[model samples]
Target: MGLAVVSLKKGEGRLLKSGGMWIFDNEIATIMGSFVNGDIVLIHDFDGYPLGKGFINTNSRITVRLLSRNEQTVIDEVFFEKRVRDAWEYRKKVVDTRSCRVIFGEADFFPGLVIDKFSDVLVVQSLALGIDRYKEMIIELLKKVLKEDGIQIRGVYERSDAKVRRQEGMELVKGFIGPEFPTLVEIEENQVKYQVDVKDGQKTGFFLDQKYNRLAIQKLCKNAKVLDCFTHTGSFALNAGIAGASSVLGVDASALAVDQAAANARLNGLEDRVQFLCRNVFELLPELEEKEEKFDVVILDPPAFTKSRSSIKNAVKGYREINLRALKLVREGGFLATCSCSHFMDYELFTQTIGQAARSAHKRLRQVEYRTQAPDHPILWAADESYYLKFYIFQVCSDR
Candidate 1:
């Protein structure tokens, strides 16, 4: 049987033309030829002109994910090897390669796959059925590419438990990809040590995307009393401790996270100065206000409050409330570091929300710095999804 061809409705290929990789299910006018789901298919515009090559998944709302715009480019081991090599090279050029996001899904052109390298370990999160079929081959090629410089990957772990996989008819599951090994892996970044449990940790263990952003707060931490809200595994708090903070208090709702954070503090020999509490940040903020508690530095690194467009309204409210509380808790002329990891919380909107929070808290904010996800997790132009993570640092002061 010949290959399948997907013809998009008129003007439907605009996202692809504009450099995005997904083709929504509703955009296709029709699919011809015999092909099953997850098969490579040719895409054409309404005028019958070839668009590119992509993997078709009838079960997914993303009907097809274009792999290449070049009509003749072949999708094989060689293609995957090149993509991995290029991604690794980019990381080597811009960020610390020891622990970084090697392949960031569509950002690196592997439409539905993400690979994060932590020391000698690799964690994979496969999100699409069409791409799932090629995951093994991709991992092999990734290892091969990494080995060119005598670097060896000890193990590969699959964390393909994202709910999006269910939309593509895949079950939520995670396990070692090859030989079994201990899941708790120790890795160091910016001189901070972390014991990452890939099997149970959030999104491939440690949040590598905030690697540099954590370093950005170091200078402001010397001898300061700092508060870290939503402190998963005590990352920001530990960074502050390592930065010579006088005392650091990290808070999280998860007792497990608090335990891990405390363990991490002990691991780094900062247990004396670094403390963690298992408490909801929202409630703790009000209590701190009641006691007139204040910190010389406050960090709010909350999880994504919004994942979809529809939740943005409520997300905005949540963000504003927490930020307003956080701002009020920061001592006058002290630092406030805040961030939102939700892509749906666009840059403009997140910044605007912060401004509203500052006004509501009756405080003035002097912008100190702005940052985003580390370069290893690069943001590709025209691929809006690649551009998440908006970080801001401000000097808070009483209003005029």
Candidate 2:
């Protein structure tokens, strides 16, 4: 196929030169002939000077996600193999264990592909058209890399349920890539044990990116009464219980998730201390307030409310409502671990949203710590915008 040319207007090439990956729709001077989604494009200045190579997706606001700056570099199977192998090499050296985010999109220079390695197995999610088009080759590269690293290849599972796939006109795929499916795998972080279910759980069966934040909660949960809202699979509650919380209450709207949370609590033998509740958090929060129920530690880890710029206002409202209610439900001097995963919502806006929530609830907050995605989920420094995950551990007070 001939190289699809993408000409950027005037100074828009600065972002690309500064190591940014995304080229928004507004940046394009011309689409330059018809090109299908996921086609490799050669980005150039108006004068036809080569800028870089990237994966094109006209459907997305981010029209192109740059893959390489080298004009000679071809984004073929060999190129993908080298990128995937380089990602694995870094993980092996930096990550303390076998389980980690093996591929982190732009951070690894393979835009729109995220692979999480759990022991011998790899769970992959191709969120962009470019990555989806090369799924087979990527899988092949992953297998070769695992074998080269002397790691047994259990299977590669595709967990592409993310909304981005749908936007890219791809169907949701979840299944084993190899012969057999691994039943369970254990991962440890900061002395806490977590059982990951790559086949049937949320987001490759675990939120490994929150590993450190969970451990932070564990330290604060000692002898405390904990409440974990939107407790998918009981991770936060179970961790608190295992960390010696006197009692933990986990609430989620999904009964399936609640059931899984209970099973996980039982698996860790913490069912005696951790309780699961299947209920809408919005309604439950008010009820808890009415009942005068308060917790020493409250976790608010809701799913991303905003996926696009259009939904940002509603997302902020939802976030604020939940944070305000949770703040009210935490005892004075208690801890509130709050988080937002919406990339559209910047950290400053998120902090401001929480501050407004606290103000409306007539509560004061002292931020204890600020956290982001785990190390395995590396952020590209040039693309500061890619650092989407945000966590704030705050101490609630009555000095409003």
Q: Which structure among the candidates has the greatest lDDT? A: 1
At residue 261, give the lDDT of candidate 2. Answer: 84
lDDT per residue for candidate 1 within 153-247, as digits (tens), equals 99999999888788998899799999998999988988999898899988788899999999999999999999999999999999999999999
294, model 1: CA deviation in Å?
1.0
Output the lDDT of residue 41, model 1. 95
Deviation (Å) of 245 in candidate 1:
0.3
Candidates' RMSD to native: 0.8, 2.2
Could you give candidate 2's per-residue lDDT for residues 301-367 as a string of tens digits? Answer: 9999987789899999999999999999999999999999888888999999999999999999999
Model 2: CA > 4 A from native: 31-36, 182-195
Q: On a 0 to 1 TM-score scale, where does candidate 2 land against the true structure? A: 0.92
